[model samples]
Target chain A: MIVDEVDKQIILATQAGLPLVAQPYQAIAAQLDLTAEEVMQRMRIMQENGIIRRVGAVPNHYKLGYRYNGMTVWDVVDEQIDYLGQLIGQLDFVSHCYHRPRHLPEWPYNLFAMVHSKTKTGVTEKVNIISQELGEFNRQQEVLYSTRILKKTGLRIGR
Target chain B: MLSDFYMQLLNDYQQDFPLTPRPYLAIAESLGVSEDDVLLAMQELTDQTLINRIGTIIKPNKMGKSMLVAMAVPEAQLQRVAGIVSSFSEVNHNYERENRFNLWFVLMSSTGELLQDTLDEIEQQCGYSTMRLPLVADYFINLGFELDLERDQELDREPDNGCDRLSTN
Candidate 1:
């Protein structure tokens, strides 16, 4: 997925959002001086390559009343991580699940799943369900709740 | 309150939004509604700030390198340190969490060298050591969140859990 200058331009132009119009691609094409077909073709290719994960509305979890967001981290059996992680990731409430290196004594958890809900109790319930799913493999777990959003400008590539 | 039509629009079109000349029209046809109706609902959603944007979600580290960095700033200096960290274009999604490592942020750059440079710069500016956690593997498929709109309505009736006050900060 080698994105050229034109592709970069397209990403820059639409990363914030597609134009709210009848012909959004045409609007993007006009801005980049490329044809609508070119924009569509490039975007389709990018989607195929997994460069563009999806093309749609990004809902604001907080605004949608999903006020409680918990980063639930777990220390699972090393050999069973991939299998356990896949199971956790498939849960509808788990938005972003990943395996990251632990920082020794301070951070013993390697598996992280971000759970969201309308209430704190709801968040805990979701965590409980995940714990049941992990079962014997789940060694230890902790949830970190974000207290404040300092910055949230998503993926900006400078021109 | 979100109408049934709005819920359908949000849930089904989180991924695989049309790439045609008239995407809204395509959506309307599939949903069995007029194009104008779909456009109006989308506009309403945007106006309410429910949806951040209708656009492409770029895969992480596909175009460049990125890492999740955390810092334990003293409470008094958290705001100042966060301001300095957020000033960098490379730093996105800075947050204050309920932990010893209070400040967490994601930093991204076009190259590996650049990413390291930005991290070093943040530590130097903030006068705090950072714990860098890079992704080892991603387990989740990148499909967008599926909104259970009806469940949200039901939950709205439940009593508060005393955590809603934290949002004021």
Candidate 2:
């Protein structure tokens, strides 16, 4: 999105993650040859424009004692999928929910909800809650549990 | 025992992480602790893998194009397929799941149109069918985990499910 020199620098610096320090912006400012205030101001603008989503900790669910996690997909009516998605997203257990295109007869689920819990029972109960939530519109659904994590890492932005 | 300050760092800052230059100092002031302590705990949390990282989650479709891709690799070819998929820098995350379409990976590209060609090449290279599930709309997307310290002392508390749309705040 028209990333200027400063914006580009900021993304690269924090892409890995803002360092765990007291003055992270100051640290970035020192590297970019700008004052801490300017760096903070620019990032505020970026956040306002939706460029920087949120500045916070991204925890590894696998390390958090959340042993059981499943991605539940639903084939809901296309017309009402958005409305249904919002309702599903609000559920406490549904960490990440999205409306994605389905491939066809082979892949029919359009709504994806990432459900996480400490145990299988927790996941099952949450799935039941979601099913009840989408009772009428739920056509077909499936939960794909991860058998192995081949790779897990954050998105790398500019450089 | 999970320190009160640590729990506060997770619960309070998950959402409006301070936009100031000295956020840890700000947090320290509020939590009645030293700035170094706040920084140390946050660093410790990250070092121990409790938190993946402390960073900005860029909004989707803002910088580049990404698609959720799945491949049905016969058990025999799963490893080979994974190696091929992982070799591509565009793939940020890949996983093996319990399903006929077992190998799932997210492929990202700087240019949006390149997505198809890359997927096509991967399919041709691996001789497997790859399904593309591009994101359409995000409802609630929060990637942060609150650690939920209260649950230990208070069993009656309901699980707090606070999710923002994945990439967007």
Candidate 3:
């Protein structure tokens, strides 16, 4: 789709990220010589067009005191993946759950779920619950605890 | 140019970031301003490149397939690898990390095979072996950005998953 110059400018500015201010839109308005309403309208359009999925704050999981966060990989049966994933996702503790290629020789887990709890034992408990709930589809599982934390940034796109 | 009012507004976002259709009105009321003013400010911040996009923090599994892919792309051909990976519609976010298994990106697709095919295509196109580290479990803490600014807390790897699990609305 053909984006006008104003839309282009808004996209470019937000590529870096939205400013953290009470009137952040005002800051952008001054930069673009447009009204804050205009900038918002354009963003709404971009979001509607799938150019941007969301504009929001990403929470930091570590700082809030709860310490046990681990990635749980499961080798679930193919046919039951959809139903099993929905069931695993229903557990509030499972923050992220999805299916990726097992990549046999390289990677062996087909379905991955993130479990967070107050302790490693808690995470393991949740994993066990998921495993039991998985029924016949559950084949194998592993938890890769993070060894280091990396910087997380929002998506940046060029128009 | 964020004013004191803007700072106050951000504070509100950090404290009680409401999850509602007209969330801005609540913020405006908290700041003693009109909802139009809050909306206008947010638009300006977005335009100026300060705050990231404001939207829902989806509790994973609600959407399509999401996987973490890593590749051992030669330094000489890093940009090419990134280009090839980014070309795929499934590749939503990509970045280079300081590790032996360097190139890291997130692939979100409706089908697992489709995600694998895209990665295989990237491997063939970029001449690098990509490692897929799809998450099996996820834990989230309520540490908003406000804490980051206040504390120069280093984002390091720690083995603790005591995070609150709430579908906050």
Leading candidate by lDDT? 1
Candidate 1, B1-169: lDDT as tens digits? 7778988877888788999999999999998999999999999888777777888877777768888888988999998999999999888678888998888888778887888888888889989989989998888576567766663353233433323211100
lDDT (tens digit, per residue) of candidate 2 on B40-108: 898877866656677777777667788889988889889998999887777878888899999888877
Model 3 spans with C-alpha error above 4 angstroms: A1-17, A32-34, A45-54, A150-159, B1-25, B28-67, B70-128, B132-169
CA-based DockQ, model 2: 0.53
Clashes of 3: 43
lDDT of 2 by residue, A1-159 (tens): 477888868876876788776788889999999999988888888988778877877665555556688889999999999999999988776777889998888889999998888778888898999999999999989998887777755675321
Better of 2 and 3 by TM-score: 2
Best candidate per TM-score, number?
A: 1
lDDT of 3 by residue, B1-169 (tens): 3366755554346433443335577677877898889878777645543444454343342334556887766777777777787777666666564445556677666567766777787788887787867664343333343321223333344543323221121
DockQ in order: 0.58, 0.53, 0.10
TM-score for the first chain of model 1? 0.94
On residues A133-158, what C-alpha lDDT tens digit does candidate 1 reach at each position?
99999989999888777777667653
Per-model TM-score versus the true fold:
0.90, 0.89, 0.52
